[model samples]
Target: MNKYNDYAKKMNCLYAELPEYLTWHKDSKEWEPRKKQEVIGRIFNCHPSDGEKFYLKLLLMHIRKPTSFKDLRTIKGKYFDTFREAAQYLGLMETDSTAEMCIEEAATYLMPAALRQLFATILVYCSPKNPKQLWLKFENFLSQDFEHKKTLNQYAIKHKVLDIIAYHLDSMGKKLQDFFFVDDDIVTRTHDNLFKEIQTERDIIIPTEDLLAIKQLNEEQKVAYDQILHHVNNNIPNAFFIDGPGGTGKTFLYRALLATIYSAGHIALATATSGVAASLLPGGRTSHSRFKIPIGENNSKPCSISKQSALAQLIKSTKLIIWDEATMAKRDIIEKFDEMLRDIMSSNIIFGGKIIVFGGDFRQTLHVILKGTKDDIIDSSIVMSPLWQHLHKLKLKQNMRASLDPHFSSYLLKIGDGIEYTNDKDEIQIPPQANVPFIDDNTTLNTLIDMVFPNINDENLDFSLFVNRAILTTRNDFVHEINDVLINRFPGEETTYFSCDENTYTCTIPDQEELFHSLTPQGLPPHKLTLKLNAPIILLRNINPNEGLCNGTRLLCKGFTPNIIYAEISVGVHAKKTVFTPRITLEAPHDNFSSIPFKRKQFPIRLCYAMTINKAQDQTLDFLGVYLKKLVFSHGQLYVALSRARSIEQLKVLIRPSTPLIQSTDYTKNVVYQEILKATDTH
Candidate 1:
């Protein structure tokens, strides 16, 4: 059995000896044992046995209570005092001079084997100089070393240590800050300070020269712009939805609106569903970051923002809130924001009587709930929200992306609208130029790769070429495979980083270890990740927004330090700039697995020669290769993959060959929920 289980069993044995302390409850008509704290405190109060005092001290150290610093210090001192007493009483620390030696002696003799090992590991890995850094390093070490042991996981270690520290602090009535230099509360405050700093430093200076460069808006765009501008200018309460397909100048219109609003010295908060989309806007932020939207949906609780908060002040003074790529967000999020605005601004009208504009194509992917059914998805979509009906719809028709190639633009529109030509079997035919015919051999894969990533061995290839070309895939497995193959082709010495994986739970139950080992969800980084010089990688976590190392930011591997990976920014506003990315712990959500309730920690970087279409959403690429090893499963997957490329020549598709080849090719299935389209059409 694991050390935790052994310790728990020992504790339970001690609990079994408390018959005299049992209270008879008249309501329940049963004898109930006293609370754990009362029991531990009572035992400690008495001139207890060495074992009893040691266990009590340990238990008290793990209990969490909110108290003052003096009390916390007293509790901490009590724990060490008990440890020293226990060691002396047991004749284990007769000559041990150091506190660490005393602790080791006391823990070895009095604590359970599992806890003994844990304490040893903590001491070996951590130091007092940088407690937080030490704790983090210790946790990483545990994850890597004890991953197979089933006694330690990231969550378990974090909670276990924090609880021990918190309990002692609580007993002394002190905060964790008194003991450890780092704590969650401190980190949260730091982030809040950073947010305020960003807000204050963020200059929304739209260059007058750039605004002058913008030509006249088309007829469709003109109508939408005029209406939005009028509403903002007159202080009219309005909620508008700008419905446009990819490359229809929604961004163009958005910029114009932002420029006009900024020029007039009015606040126009530009936000998007994604980081990439948000970056396209003038002083834009992701809606979640800007509004402090909770990670999970909770209808009962509003946003964490209070009326006195700086964010609240910003919202109050804001003239317009333009949420780009709105269709990607869940309806509940929109409703929650609405509720928060109403609560904050004290208005019953939609979005607290503010002019909020949401823009995105309904034809694109909606709210993506993992493993959710089609019905679940549609229900969660923003179009299904009650507030959607209140939205004034504005459509942008002329395709700005394909304005030079009108025929190609028409073809794209047909595909997106699901009006593309199909045979009797309902299979769409691939255009001759766009389709890379599948030759019935392994060379087909090689041919496709050569065409997509040409001059792979060229030493002097510009970094822009890497940014321009990407292979899009339906599955993460294919993405990994293609990335591996492509990275190998790149001329450089490779550096492979192996992730430390561990079961976060110390399971006493049978077969739990086996179960955890089998669980590998999507979005979790692999055990072994390889990188080479000039190879591209995508950031899985938001490292630093100021340096443009946010999630979805792409970087090309340039060099490496002993502890950090140096890379040049390959995408976003900080493109071509070199940045240092450190090895940081990242935890994939537990909910994505079988409700296992354990986070998998790993480095937050992934190879990016190819990427899943879901990750590629809202990103526009110059050259895209759609390699379909399997059929596109989710809604708008095919459309999203195809629409990533700017023009026809820039895109290439390679489908798996059919045994009985015919005139019609097996194209990607287009899943458009007709009811949603109908609802939007009527609006």
Candidate 2:
């Protein structure tokens, strides 16, 4: 009888029919069971050797050394395909790389060396001549060591080989999960040998039963998920631009594909543009980390990993890769990442030349460096790159945002033109009594506290009450002048501010060191502070900066209260030298503005909802206040503001008879009208 069979049978009898298997053997160290011996005898009769010769043959089969990437790939193939044909071919092939890979793969899958040694020592006691006698010796050894906790009982036959392994070794640990083959504890050669023992080509052999048991999804998600799954299974290598409007179930599809590949015994990797987004998914890391992609490395330099490195191993073992917020990836970033993978894998490829998926909306661009269009992928570093292609694309059109401002919110994107507001949809509760009194001139505007906050208990109003004035003016002022007003309003309150422009604003603070210390441990920068401000003022910086900041010698600002105080004046420079200058230039186009308050400071300007045409673009407001003079509104300017509102009631065109709302000889005007017509048709 083979040693493993004897062991397996003895364990089976112990668990199922111990009493029936009991027997007395005086010469033995402990008592034995007759049934246990009989089962061991049956196992011997069923098969011959202890599988030692097969294992040894498998170990000695390969000859090639594994250092190059090609060698690693070859070994990876044989490691995964454990069957007669594959094993025989690998055994006959004399490749050092193949042998090394086999050793590595086996070690990864099998138990540690310490446990193997204990199993081998116990094997010495088992003999075919006195099966019952041997059984007695084993039982006694186990009983005596029960106090020492060195004995084990569990055993199972592996499905592919039907070969026995110590499934439950008491000496190894209470559970398999508790054991790990970490780097420090390993003896390099012994580790290599142990790996060789377990090395065999073993493809994933999922039974029909397990697959049948998986939970499924609703019809729509199922179809979409299946399409992606099929593409992955085929290993279709290409960029996939999946555009779904915000709140569509696009993320759900990504999760489904990941789960499938994982269930099939393959690893999956996930990444995204932001750490916050990465945190939302299981096993997600930043794309920069995954690709070893350095920030601002926009050119030919590429990151590469050795074929035998742990990172490369992890990637090779993974079957699927998912990238979210893909729209933020610039052309250069994607190309550099692809270049690195190709070098590591030794193949010109797309999707790292494996199963890869991407999810994002192109309209939300965050990549500032890449200039190439979506279709162009040129690799100057390589004579040839993978042919430009896309694998599969899915578009999601559903809108899921704050429901209270559905129509208004929807119009912010061109796609939202079709959205209709429904009472049944989600709603944002704005208290009906929250509306506040309005004013025109500086004094009345200064009394505009209720607009920011409705009641005494409303904390939003506290800032307005604490500040000195809310001056209303149509003339643009230089930033320094604005800072002056802010410093005058709040003499000593510390403040926070930022700009969402291409280049972030920098400020030099007098208390830079103190501010740095105060913000540390919280990870905020020294000059950046946090403050709360009213929505309109916030919107001015965030959305309507194109309207204009006051013209003057622009200088850094600080020390503010109620979130709008500006301080720290510097000699504003023009052409890098001329400073403290007052000359202003309106070089850029301006957003429509409400007319200067008529009748001086007599009454609050009538419901001014002024916005720049750029900020106004794609917006459909409940009401719009467009102020115009003699120059005709460009087709570009007119359409940008008009589209913001859903209908005419939402639009209030405040134009004089001579304002020239329409004019001839403007080709761009025709184009704007056609686009509006198209938008209307879609709805």
- Could you report the Cα RMSD, in angstroms, for every candidate shown? 17.9, 33.8
lDDT of 2 at 130: 33
lDDT of 2 by residue, 1-683 (tens): 11224433544432123334554467885445465445422111111132433322332222222333233234334442232233333332122232222222323323233223222222321112332343333332322323244343332111110111122221111212222321222323223332221121012233333244234444545566666677667765555545654444555556566556656666677666544344334445557655566654333556644566555666666667788876555555666766667766778666457666677643332343234432231221111223223445556665433344465345434422322222232211111222112222243222332232224234434433322112121112211123233333432333333211111114432212112222211111112223222212211110001111111112233222221122222211111111111101111111122111111100000111222333233223433433322222222343344334444334433222232352221111101223322321232
**Poorest 10 consecutive residues of model 2 by lDDT?**
598-607
Best by TM-score: 1
lDDT of each: 0.65, 0.34
- Residue-wise C-alpha lDDT for candidate 1, range 1-683, written one tens digit per residue: 11234334334433323333444479997655555535422233322245645434433332223133233224323433544443333222222223233233333222232232333322322223444544444443323334456697766655555544332232222335554546666434433442342344245668665476345677888888889888888999999999988889898888888888777777778888877777667677778767877765453465787788656787888889999999889888899999989988999999999999899987777777867998898888887888988999888888876657788778777776777887666666666788887765356677778888898878787755777578998888788788888888888776665443344556543323223434545766665567888788888764444345456778888764323466677765557766544334345465745544444333468888898888888888878898877777766777788889888888888887444554334464555676667778764
**Model 2 clash number:** 26
Error of 2 at 185 (Å): 9.2
The CA lDDT at 348 in model 1 is 100
| Best of the candidates, lDDT | 1
